[model samples]
Target: MKKVLFASTALIATAGVAAAEVNFSGYGRFGIGYVEDRSETTIVRGPGADGLNGTADDVLARSTAQTDDVILVSRFRLNIDGIAETDGGVRFEGRVRLQADEDASNGEANSAGLNGARFSVIYGGLRVDAGNVAGSFDNLANYYGNEVGLELFAGQYSGVDYNFLAYSSTGSGANAVFFQYSVGDFSFGASYDQAQATVIGAGGTTSTTVDADRWDISATYTFNNITAAVAYGQTDAGVAGVSDPSLTVLTLGGEWGDFSGTLFVADDATQVASTDGTAWGLSAAYNLGAATTLLFTYGDGNASADTQQVAIGAIYDLGGGASLRGGIGRNDCDSCASDTIVADFGAQFNF
Candidate 1:
């Protein structure tokens, strides 16, 4: 098992009779993994690979890995959360990610950067946010219930990675603006992103960044152990030749007794680098006895090539915010000619 150290500090200060609280928190995970047959076939990049019929044979030209792949999977995140209240009943909240262990092109560390930072100003039940804000569609569903031992291997299904609106270029982190409203058990949110305000083409030449804007809206309802959410969004590819891209996502999640899970689906448009259709997934987590839990996930990408993936994993609690985790999975293309085998064994902890 791996080991992790955690710490927290709280501070309260007064500025003109208005008090504020600042808290520090972070989490880290590490593990070992082995992967087979990994590629960027359907992933949406600039344009896309040629002959994208969603078939493996069609995309045989894709860059495939060299047989069995071994890797070390690890990540560390540190965030500072701050809250301040005004005498007028308004509030301000912000979060800043202080360090990223590995986010470089060559898998090196970034020296004290702010990768997942965001800030918000609030009044009544409405709030506005900016900087590294999450998109409404993705904020609602980051594959809520999926579980895997080694993210470098099986990881999340391809559907979660390419939500049309959640493209690889700007989905993870982007410069954006967002609005949110909360009332009792219901909440609503909307986001607009200018993630690529300056576009540099293949040759590092400058191009107009007007067409890179994107927007989306989402709603979530939670009552006890049951929750439901829906979101819709669109993205413009900036340069012409392809249609504008869009996505509609829905999720239903619930927990009863010792069982909990999530079901989701997505309708995608502007399938520039992926299948031109719909995708869906289901995940389940069941507690066994006192300290062990079982995890399962299944997914289907309703593309011309019929993509499907599944994973089976388990978790063993070690108390004090740590757990032993491992899983083995297989992903295959029924209509196409591609397949993958993924496995990992490791430990994770939260602080």
Candidate 2:
């Protein structure tokens, strides 16, 4: 991520338009994070009988747990890109991002700046993007490869919980539209969006403000070294007690030498809750040659079986773009009351 060239330019506003190129990369991570016992929910207001403090009779409270802790986490991101080309051979691009963390919102680090820009158009293998697009089931290739530790953590794809349509770096977010295409090893994508959300009903008071119409589609193929993919998504909440959700994903991966793996399945459905079913996972990595590497992941957490998780990690490589990661895991769900142990250690870099 670090390419730079700015020829005839008025600094990207294309003053006289002749050339443009701008690229800068991003990455940064920091760590030492751990968690074991953690649960805290508060909304106690027991007071029926004209007891003080605004309430029509109040009564609700119960949730608490706290014991283990270890923290210090961080993040930083920045990316900016711009490119141009066109005479007959089309090309144009744009991107932007700037991020910060250490608990993004509440902690308020940098408080959301940049973001919201994504533009593209290219020809040959086809490409198109608009505003903050990035949905095609969230840009499916390898379906996230299962991620592992040092915070990559997608183990079990995190139970998915469907209601897809992604890419929101603030601003124009779901003002999406996307496209993708490739020919040889096969590739394809699709996306769409329409937004205005805020729906909540039943037991949690009530709320409404519908109009949502997400979309997604994906495809991929590659033989020999494997690689297979599929995706699907939908959202359409046309009201009527709202509930219309779907997602499907499938993946298969390969690389066999110093090993590499992937296997995934997702069926994150939703009819408004219970989180629906199907979520599977497996991830692997190995490459112990001088630069070192090793990782693993496992997940299952969609409807029953007490949920699950597993992990392992390692990485080292301090050549140029830095590295050194860490991991550890154990997770369990069903609202958890028992299993949970997480760990982290890190250092990352990228220009």
Candidate 3:
């Protein structure tokens, strides 16, 4: 993304700071996608034991069938960032985003609008952020290095299953606090988030409050052209009958001339019985020329069955902050009657 600076005298005067700067930047992507095993459910109604049509006793059943469909996908995001520095060298900053996504079948309409805000304080190599903050788990280096496709989906190796807080783009995220420090080739981060909601009784005189809390920590170190990172996170459910989830992950990645590769493993207990074990993945890319790169990725979910995926793709530079990318991948899904095939082609640009 490229940043465009704002030079409004009114903004500087209103901030009353020694120096202030504001900038805008973001990206947009659009593409077509196909799924070989897409499916949908249909409801059928029939007479019950009474054996009478149009009677009160009727049965409804749901049946699923493969759609094997294709669809269009797109997204646009705009980021606005403002910073002000005091004479003492301390800097205060704030950021917000406007984002929109294509409305596909069964997808909700997401119109562009300003979502949540994050405020930060920065000094030297240390920074602190509050409100709509990114959690430590999601901020780990190379955590999402395996992502591919137009939608940037991580096939079988989902690093963490939303067990940690993330910056929300369409709404105010959890009340959160995060901090990070970097020195030389070492960096560390930690975050905590909480959300609560009150439910009112039918009579409006009784109410109950439900609370959820989460926290995570991460550290990264680089040596000899290799970077290693570790992240751990836990979530506590304050509601009855809800199970807590936890995740621990490690990642190692490096760039060697025209070749780059990353390896990651994660142990997660997210209450999803099918994906609860230890999962691992590898992602690699090699530059074929000045304008193209070849990519490959593989992952083993370590589940009871059908727990693997492999994909190959390429990226072509279009120059001027634009590129064309595509990939074809297969997922060994346990629930699918057959292996699922997915493919996508798209163009992306940053400004």
| Highest TM-score scorer | 3
- Expressed as tens digits, the lDDT of each residue in 1-351 for candidate 3 is 123223354466447665887778999998887777566767677765555444434536778876536877788999988888888888999989999986544233468888789999999999999999889866888776756687764443543344578888868877699999999999999998876656544434455777767889999999998999999887776667878778888999999999999988998777777667787888988999979988888877656552577888888999999999888887765554677677889999999
Q: What TM-score, over all chains together, does every model reach?
A: 0.75, 0.30, 0.81
Candidate 2 lDDT over residue span 160-206, tens digit each: 77757777654557667889999999989988887777765544344
Q: What is the lDDT of residue 198 in candidate 2?
A: 72
Summarize candidate 1's per-residue lDDT along 1-351 as a digit string, tens digits. Answer: 122222222212444445687777877777766666533223323422333343222323444233326556667767788888888888888887765443312233445556555778999889888877766865675445566664533323445434423312212366678888989999998999864545544433333555667899999999898888998887777666767678777888898999988887877665554566787888888999789988888877767554677889888999999988889888776456767777877887888
Report the candidate with higher lDDT, 1 versus 3.
3
Q: Which stretches of candidate 1 lie over 4 Å from their true place?
A: 1-18, 37-68, 99-112, 141-143, 150-157, 160-172, 195-209, 238-242, 304-307, 334-337
Write down the worst ten-residue block by lDDT for model 3. 1-10
Question: Sorted on TM-score, highest at the top, how do the candidates line up?
Answer: 3, 1, 2
| Highest-scoring model, lDDT | 3
Model 1 TM-score (2 dp): 0.75
Candidate 2 minimal-lDDT segment of 10 residues: 1-10
In candidate 2, stretches whose alpha carbon ends up further than 4 angstroms from where it belongs are 1-19, 22-81, 84-132, 135-157, 167-212, 215-234, 237-242, 245-269, 272-302, 305-307, 322-351
Candidates sorted by lDDT, best first: 3, 2, 1
